[model samples]
Target: MPIDMSVWQGRSDPEDGNKGLRWHQKVQPADNANESGIMLLGFACDEGVSRNKGRTGAYDAPVAIRRALANLAWHHEAPVYDGGNISCDDSNLELAQYRLAEDVSRALRQRHKVIVFGGGHEVAWGSFQGIGNYLVQKQHVAGNANEAQQPPRVGIINFDAHFDLRNPPGGKQSEKGSSGTPFHQAARFCELHNWPFKYVCLGLARTSNTQALYEKADRLGVLYKDDHELVHHKMEQTLTELQRFIDQCDYLYLTIDLDVFPASVAPGVSAPAARGVPFDIVEMLLEPILKARTPKGEPKILVADLAEYNPRFDIDNQTARLAARLAWTIARAIR
Candidate 1:
């Protein structure tokens, strides 16, 4: 589970110096916890996918994403570090999530912006927990001794084809959660802690989600825009709503499930979208969120992740390259 140093290799052109630099030449292992910058963590687990009866090859996504990103042009000035992968051993998905949470919390504590590469959409649970833990610690350190005090609101914005709100199989409490249950679990977590569950989902396919899930989302007061509503003609209205959502939150957690894109663009996902949103539109929506800042001048996005990338079905590494491009975009937006 250590940082796979081999994947971080690519072309080199010393003659051009900085102009020719790429991520492979710039990214270093985050060996020092005190180093504050951007950190990339990998969730090398597909057990959740298996449980959800989806494709299983997403477990290898981190390495594939890194390889794809390695040769991309480095366009940012911030120090980038590879925090390594957290592998799921056997069927213990819960344990793997706990480990991921620990690493994510540690990176955040060190003031490193985290961008996790996922094994599945299930990575959301661990990533959410880590962000929640960090917020709790931060609040405690700030002398907010009263637990009853309103905690900072953290908004979750997900770009995905499915709602991922299914409960554990058979409604059994002892059953392990799957890739389709992360948001449901997150909602429960928010309720347990008495925090507002501010979630907005974009690019959801109407045919992909069931009526029960829609009802669940309504009950949870989730804000969403379907795929049909994100067209060029409706973009202005969509972005206006998105901006209003952003304005209400103190922080943001952005998660992109590659399956939200058309199968032609992201065929290597657990569930390929038949009529997905175009990459240009996704990028357009992402631009405002990435550039958004709080009233105090700090970036509103605390953490972000890319999920559901399965390389086994990829054609010409198309999906990896796209994921890499998104990662590059996120990296460049970091301030």
Candidate 2:
């Protein structure tokens, strides 16, 4: 895949030198052989969102979000890589998803930290597939190590407005999965592989999710906190729950759906939150977790992603800017 240089833009001032260089000037196309820095992979498909009966503009989000991120000043020494995108058409969702998994797997194999920008929440399925495959491969290579020497567990933390636990139509992949069903797919994948799925969902909206969804989440043993509880009150308690969950896992994958923020700050999503958690609060919750090391002295966070930003409905690019800032936060926070 070729890098789309067209998405990157910023002024280069010789007088100011390195101080004036933005992310666009600093980021390069990925060199898989180079075992260093962060790589950005874009999933440019909204067929999943459309199939889930949501808006159609999310397919164009990767470029729009990149345009927002490109002009931001580069403050970290970690080099950034634009690994290009995995695009999908209406007739080929499965192929695109498979290619994304392959690309993600390739990156992980080379020990590069990955930041995936999504076409929709469905991006999680591909992202999880890649990470799982890589870890499973590692286990096989270990070749019957003692239980204490086994590979660490993988945990997922998602910040979103809805549970996204809807059952796939006809109850299988042949029915075609959607943005609203990625986590469901992920949970099933975990079960099939016997991988410990320590999944935690934050910033859920009680009004947005149906009773059936809640029941499904309960049956799956998913841990979740609603928006009201986290944003309006019990903030400390929420953090405690999050900490407890994080403490039990060795490797973590963080996914943020922009809709988890208030509509005023992020209106360009398929489902905007009426009263969502503030960005600052989210930063508060993430900073320590991202910076922390596991009990085994390994970095807790392995890969992260930002999902569900639709450029078509944005106002003054507010949503895109938020996405960029969050990406910047992740880059700086990762150890």
Candidate 3:
């Protein structure tokens, strides 16, 4: 779980003036508590994918993503820090997720905008837990000054081809969680705490998910748009709905599963989309969420992550580059 210092290395040019600045030049270790800015964390795990009977190479995605991001042009004014990787070793996927949650909570408490690079969609579980823990801690610190204050309403916006709400092959007690069960787990967590599960899914493929999953989504009151509905003509409506979702929540957690893009655009995921939404459309949808702020001027996005990039299946590092580009966009757009 230590930071791989070598992954951040890239070409440096001192003579090019401001044009020479790149992520490698700006990114520092997230070891200093006083410096608050963007914190990048990697979830080095593929056990979830393996358990779900998908490809197994996603565990190496963190390093791949960092290598792709290292040379990208830097435009953000805030400091960037690498918090290293939370690795799932020895097939102990649960333990790794717990560790990731701990790190994420710590980073948020320190007031850093977090971007988690994933091993699989399973990363969502850890990220969700971390945000939840941070909110609880913040509420506790606020004390009973306002007993009437309601808990923060967290809305999750997931861009994926699949619903990813499947239970393990067996029941929960008989099997551990997998890449396809994170959102379901999140819903259960919210239910246990008596909190609302406000989830919005985009780019769903009717062929990728089963009827049972659709039923589950409806029961959970999940709002979603199919791949067919995300076209250029309908984008305005989509953005309007997205804004409504944002308006209802005090915090937002955005997670992008690379498989949501066409196979040609993101061929390295565990499950590539047969017919996916275009990257430009996805970016268009993301812009408003990235820029959204509370009436108090506080940023609504508390934490975000990109999941399920399997480098082993990548073509000419296409998926890696796209993930890095999305990360870059997030860093620049977040206030």
Candidate 4:
């Protein structure tokens, strides 16, 4: 029998075709006379998790997501530089992630808006570190030493399957990046750095969180709203409040766990949410931020990354399409 090679087709030219559509330019973040709004980044999550055990082929998420996003061509006016996927080889996960985050920082420096396709939620650690570093450096250059601690204004918005607030299920303080703990690690970093944090977690009604997680959230004062609460309340009103929260921060970054969408809508995520945010609700909740329309001389923004897409579990790439579409919506509306 002869070996097949088409399975590796996308690997060689990851940026070529997205959702069967061609993209004109998919390169490093750039600044041009046309003055585009945001930079688009994509990546696979952590390095070593087995595909079957975790989320099927989530490692290939970046490519498929880029393809999906590339297909839309709706936000054509937005200046977009496809920074490509972060190299997620397990041998040096941190370094790979840091390099990718550095690319994100570079985009921030150029004042490009960002929406990253991803590997797993764990990449948030490095991404945050990169953004925080940029904020700190810029403040020093501006001679705001006294306000450096607060220079990098940031907020948290998430739609995830779990709170990810568990504190060392085994009592160890820190562990290498894992799907189950990125939020906790990220919160710790944000709190230590004194960044403006209005952490609002949405679509997390299903989880195996223990009492310890609740106690931890209590201690930290994390603001989380469950699916039920989101359903009964006016979504637009709640999103208005959420926008106000992000407006208070100097830098804004959002993380989307594919599982926040119902299994029917986004089956490609790491954990498919049995009951997830509807397309309309998700759109409404994100409208304020998407319609931000911030121009130059305004605050430089830290990019948003969409993580944890496992196409092996997807239904005809529907979830990938939705996630990519959502990324574009946010990009167009970003300030």
TM-score of each: 0.96, 0.94, 0.96, 0.81
Candidate 2 clashing pairs, residues 3+ apart or interchain:
none
Q: Model 3 — which ten-residue stretch has the worst lDDT?
A: 167-176
Rate residue 284 of model 2 by lDDT: 78
lDDT of 3 by residue, 1-335 (tens): 35666898788889998878989888888775467798999999999999889988899999999999999987888898899999888989888888999999999988898999999999999999999888877877775677666767899999999998887667743337899999888887787777899999999999989999999899998989999999999988999998998899989999999999999999999998999999999989998899999888877888899999999999999999999999999888774
Q: Supply candidate 4's per-residue lDDT for 301.
A: 41
lDDT by residue for model 4 over 1-335, one digit each (tens)?
A: 12111111222334645433333333333433146457666666545234214644677887777667654544344456655566676657667667877877777777676677777776666677667677767877776546434445567677676676655344436545566666676676766766545566777764545667767766766667666557636775677677777666655667877777778888777777777777777667766554443355453346677878888788888988887787766665664
User: What tens digits encode model 2's per-residue C-alpha lDDT throughout 252-272?
Assistant: 889999999999989999888
Clash list (residue pairs), candidate 3: none
* C-alpha lDDT score of every prediction, in listed order: 0.90, 0.83, 0.90, 0.64
Q: On residues 1-335, what C-alpha lDDT tens digit does candidate 1 reach at each position?
A: 46677898899999999899999998998885455789999998899999999988999999999999999988888899999999886889999988988989988888888999999999999999899889878878775566566677899999999898888886724336999998887887777777899999999999989999899899988899899888999999889999999999999999999999999999999899999999999999998899889898878888899999999999999999999999999888965
Candidate 2 accuracy as TM-score: 0.94
lDDT of 4 at 88: 70
**Candidate 1 — which pairs collide?**
none
Model 4 lDDT at residue 225: 64
